[model samples]
Target: MAKIAYILLCHKGPEAIIGQAEMLTAAGDYIAIHFDGRAKPEDFQQIKAALADNPNVTFARKRIKCGWGEWSLVQATLLAVEAAVQAFPRATHFYMLSGDCAAIKSARYAHDFLDAEDVDYIESFDYFDSDWIKTGMKEERLIYRHFFNERKHKWLFDTSFHLQQRFGLKRDIPHDIQVQIGSQWWCLRRRTVEWILDFTRKRRDVMRFFRTTWIPDETFFQTVVRHLVPDSEIRTRTLTFLMFTEYGMPQTFYNDHYDLLLGQDFLFARKISPEAIELKQRLGALYSNDKAEFKISNEGTSLFKFLTGRGRIGRRFASRFWETESTLGRQRELMIVICKKWHVAKRLLEQIRQVTNVPAIEYLFNEEHTDLPDLGGIQTSLGKRTRHRRALMRMLFDYYETDQMIVCMDPSALDLLQDFASDRSTTRMLEVQCVFSDEYLIGHAMRVGLAGEQTSAETLERLLPTIRGDMTFESDKIRDAEFEHHYIINEARDAEENAAPLSNFLDISHDKARQIAQSDHLFAD
Candidate 1:
């Protein structure tokens, strides 16, 4: 088993943070927390008391008065990481998260997924990249000196920044090291983390340069990691899900985003507000049962009666029945159908749900329509149009939790699905099938079927196994597999036949395919 160390930077919402910590608590997992020095000491003590019983939980001895875009935030993270490393020398990986973040998958799933991967999952991009900024570059962040004490020196700093910009006099970026920027949250291997600490310690000049530079927290680690690791070894993607508004602020997740979050292939989600207590509770309950093995019981009273104290046994049994029914009698196999037309997806899902007791049945639909029955686990508005369907597919694969098999299909391909499901031998174990279109041109049909007019050959290749059948007999192997149980079906034949112009345009190597598979294709057309 892999040991993971989670370094949390928390400043508010003590209860929410505690809930996150509890959800992620597992054997060989260590939680090292750093309460911002600016936060109330009493609050810190209270949080400490709440987690005092967990031996794997630790607090940073040196706290920093962390502020947005300041060096203190970086310092606090360093302190927590150092504490965690010192406490758990055998920890295999280090995860940096904020208080607002919550685990979206089971601890077992996260461990298994990380253990199978050898690369570092850090989202880093060149500072000068076009996609790095939307409005324009803020030269002052990298070129001018701005005091961290924004409250006291607000006017002075503003004047200094404008004056430098006006005079066309900008500080030169360090020539020896290339600058990089990305999301602050990251998951790095133990060796990579140790290297970061050592590199920062040895290079005081790098530290000094970033201290006076604006928003050093975002660039410091990204720059150093990119400088040291090969591009092939770095997976320019973070395991946390964050949605930003048009104005460039982190969008707060709400109850409405619950399904969206669950569909994502991310371990953690961020910016959960304290007021969204219902969402918090739902996530807590959902992940609570996400262990290495599934345990079924007739024990425990009904939650409703446990709240009302009126009816107990009868309601408890009813609740249990509902759970079993919704989860396809707890059989473990999951079938997810993706379709652009809601009506098509609805009919297909209804037919499958009625015939099969596959543990889970979820629908990833492109459009939102009314009067759609509550077909158990069906998810709608996955994306606005067909182009966004792959985004939805990526989410479904990322946060999938069951130990059973997963089958995905197009509504048009339901006949094949029914045939596959009816054949017990085919559906009993894992399977992979690549379906080709005999009538329409495969590439044109693919563009019409999926959200993006373009699809990666690698993406198409990855989805093939879900349609055909690939079984992993051992439970351990299923858990450790990168895509152990998912079934992906798209309209393409063998890799050779898919060598047309459009296919050639999208055909990338396996390494590139894995990266594209994990990306958010919401913006793809």
Candidate 2:
């Protein structure tokens, strides 16, 4: 049987740590804990009282104060690893985790699983090639020396990082080892742990260089294992399931996510919420009867794409509309069409372009994009060109009304209505709605967002060349005259008779339509 040594490096949540320790020990696993050096005395005492009598658990010597993206975290992890090795000499697999990590599978299953495997599990990707790190400094992380903890002294950290780059101050790596990066969570064979620790001790100069390296905990052991271990021996993946958001924060597991945790092949999951008392208890009781087959449905990649696409909108050009630095921004008369249906919106866009004569921009502010170009060809303002681009934006849409009242059509940025509602310039807004989308109406199933999906099913007649082409149409007549607020209910689709009366439907649907326009919210004050 493979005896697993679970090395837990934790900062906060001592009670959660106690639960994990008890759970691991009950599962016939060895435990080593490194409570953050800066942990509260009372919290530390509670942990000690809970696990002090347990034979399977051992405390790491010289518990270091862990800081985000600093050397202390690596030190804490190493301390726990050493303690585990000394306390549990029979352990074959050494699994790394944090205080919040808990066993989602039975110990017998994990033991049998690893006992059969000859490979070590760790994420080892080339640092230079992989686009893993989301928010912070990437290549710059190694190129410059980070002195201050980024969380505590963000300004100083950023300033020093840039200043070093500005002055061309560069540091040399000890052995010029190709820096491989990965998640800190790893499930390694005892030999790998030994090799990593020995390498850490032997390469004091490497350790010295890593002391000032950003997020050394994520890089140090990963880079070392890749260098020492053969490719065939390493699995290049972790048994532990942990997810970091694009914002670079660990997504916390809660009681509701119990089924989600159970469904995965991961033995353990990191960063369980301290408040998830029921979740912790449920995870502690997870003991499988048979050795489960190791087919994992890791929702890591799928969930990350969703989370990143939704959260990191600033990185995309479509989401950007406002500029902080504005000079001489006089109010301008602008007409904006707020519509979700692209076919209907495109038709309106054509009419506006005809009325204005200089390309009524399609989806200038809409986050989502289809095959059609998203940026509106003129919305982007990268780096130094931002000034002139912003000037052009102001000239085109904001500074003053053009001779023919040039329109700026956007499908997603509904907030723009609220922004310009109270402006001195007479702003006209047409909240267009297609009865075809009555099934996916506002405030319900439909949300026009940065999903990059174009929801349009215009009929063959509507998509005809005559209607779609550059011919002057009836819709163009609407733009010829000035209108403050118009609700163009596009009755394009076939309306079917339902249980509800026509009068009842009209009353309820139009009321919702008015709300969708959100004109009242803008002009309420």
Winning model by TM-score: 2
Q: Give the TM-score of candidate 1.
A: 0.54
Candidate 2 Cα errors over 4 Å, as ranges: 244-248, 288-525
The global C-alpha lDDT for each of the candidates, from Candidate 1 onward, is: 0.58, 0.62
Write one digit per residue (lDDT tens) for candidate 1, span 281-350: 8777766555433332312223222532322244433333122222121222334443333333344333
How far off is residue 442 in model 2, in Å?
50
Span of 10 residues, lowest total lDDT, candidate 1: 321-330
Report the number of backbone clashes for model 2: 0
Return the clash pairs for model 2, or none.
Answer: none
Kindly list the per-residue Cα lDDT of model 2 for residues 1-525, writing each as its tens digit: 888888888755676678778877887788898887765667888998988899999989886866667898888888889888888889888888876577787777788778887988989899988987654468877868999876445458778988998899998766668898998888888998998888987988888888899989789888988889899999888888777543233555778887777767688887676557898776666653344434467675575566556534656433323342232133334455655455555554443332222225455444333212112344343332233434344444322212113234443343445444444454556655443322333212234241223434453333334332322233444444434444343343222321122113222343333333332222111
Give candidate 2's whole-model lDDT. 0.62
Candidate topping lDDT: 2
